[model samples]
Target: MKILLIEDEKDLAKSIQDYLKTNDFVCEWVTDFSLALEKIALYDYDCILLDLMLPRGNGFDILSHLKKLNKSDGVIIISAKQNLETRLEGFNLGADDYLVKPFHLSELLVRIQALIRRKKFDGNNIITFNEIQIDLLSKVVKVHGISIDVTKKEIDLLLFLIGNNKKVLSKEAIAEHLSGDMADMIDNHDFVYAHIKNIKKKLKNAESKSYIKTVYGLGYKWEDE
Candidate 1:
């Protein structure tokens, strides 16, 4: 999933970014509230980690801006404020979860996972489509009791398609979802086609019906009907 972490603390931001990257998540971080606002305006993030206190602007302002945009971006507030008022205010502004500083990174991760689960999958760890079952928490894919051996990107691709089933996903959109802003710098999105091909090959090999279709001159869609 794509995560935008807006924390002004340099050390903490770097640590969190490094840790999340190691855990198979694409994370973009900004230390300034202005930068955070720009990112939120320009991109669609699966989740946002927001710290209430920022140098130029407060995180609450960012929250209000997000609401104005009608963005369903899952937000987790991480701040030093442990008071009830702050927590309540964050929740009032539509924060999915709140975590205080000086907490374990593990705990923060757990909360973030829970928030993502709630926002994206309705708190389900397993995602199902037809005969295919994906254990999101474990990162496993199964087809008719047979486990599939797939790479991380393969699983990401499958989940993205399944989540947006029946919707056409542009090559640029797919690349952005998988590779974040770096997608724009690439010379080609042919890699997306390669991933699609691999996914189709694996599913077809397992006697599964192909659900992905190409929209010539446009993009691809995950349509089963």
Candidate 2:
């Protein structure tokens, strides 16, 4: 999954990025509020880790902007502002969850996963569609009860496709989702095609239903047969 962390503390941001990357997440860190707003305006994230206190702006304003844009990206306020009023303001501004600082990384990871699940999969950690099953926490994909030997990127692509089932996802969107805001920096999006091909082959080999559909001139979609 991809996350935009809008935290100002360099050490905490680096530590969070390292830990999240180890768990198969593409984390993009922004030190100031302006950069955070730039990212929010440009790309979509599965979840955003926002800090209320920033050098350039307040995180609450960011949340307000997201609401104004009608963006459905999940947000979690990770702030040192621990007062009830602050927490209430966050949720009222469309924050999904709140995490106070001086907390455990593991807990933060779990919260991110949970928020993603609630936003995308209707609060289910284990996603089940036909014979395919994906455990978000364990990062496992199984077809007909058999685990598939797929790379982490492939798994991420699978989740992205399934989560947006019945919706056509453009190549650009997929690329950005997998690579975060650096999608445009990549030389090309051939890796997106490669991952799609590999996932199709693996699922076919495991006897899973063909659900990924190609839109002739558009992109791809997860359509039911």
Candidate 3:
């Protein structure tokens, strides 16, 4: 999954980023409100980690902008400041969860996982589509009760496709989701084709139904046959 972490503390942000990476999550971080504003305005994230205190501006301003845009990105407020009023304000401004500073990285991971599960799979860690079953917590994919050897990147690609269901996903979108903002610098998204091909092969080997469809001149979509 991809997360946008809007935090100002350099050490803490790096620690969070490094921790998230070890768990197979892509976390893009911004230290100031201006960049946070731009990221929320332009891109979509599985979840957002917002620090209430920032340089030049506060998290509330960024939260307000997100609310105005009506983005579905799940948000968790992380701040040293704690109170009922602040908590209520964060919720009123579209925050999904809150975590105080001096928190455990493991606890933060659990929170992010729960939030993403709620947002994507309606609070279920297991994603089932026909014979395919993906256990998010264990990072396992099974077909007909048989385990498949799916890589982490392949798992990410599979989730992205299944989460969108029937929506057409452009190669650019796939690349950006898998590679973050760095995708914008690349002239080709052909690597996305490779990921798709691998998933297709694995699913076929496991005797799963074909769900991913190429849209010819457009992109790809997960459609029921």
C-alpha TM-score for every candidate: 0.95, 0.97, 0.98
* Global Cα lDDT for candidate 2: 0.92
Task: Please report the TM-score between candidate 1 and the true structure.
Answer: 0.95
lDDT of 2 by residue, 1-225 (tens): 999999999999999999999999999999988998899999999999999999979999999999999999999999887999999999999999999998899999999998898899999989999899998878899999999998889889999999998999999999999998788999888888888888999999998888999897688999889
Candidate 3: stretches off by over 4 Å: none
Which residue pairs in candidate 1 have backbone atoms (N, alpha carbon, C) closer than 3 angstroms, thus clashing? none
Model 3 C-alpha lDDT per residue in residues 1-225, reported as the tens digit of each score: 899999989999999999999999889999998899988887899999999989889999988888788889999999998889999999988899999988999999999999988988888989999999999989999999999999999999999998999999999889988988888898898899999999999999999889999999889999889
lDDT (Cα, tens digit) per residue for candidate 1, span 142-223 = 9876898999998888888887788898999899889988998999999999999999999988878889999988899988
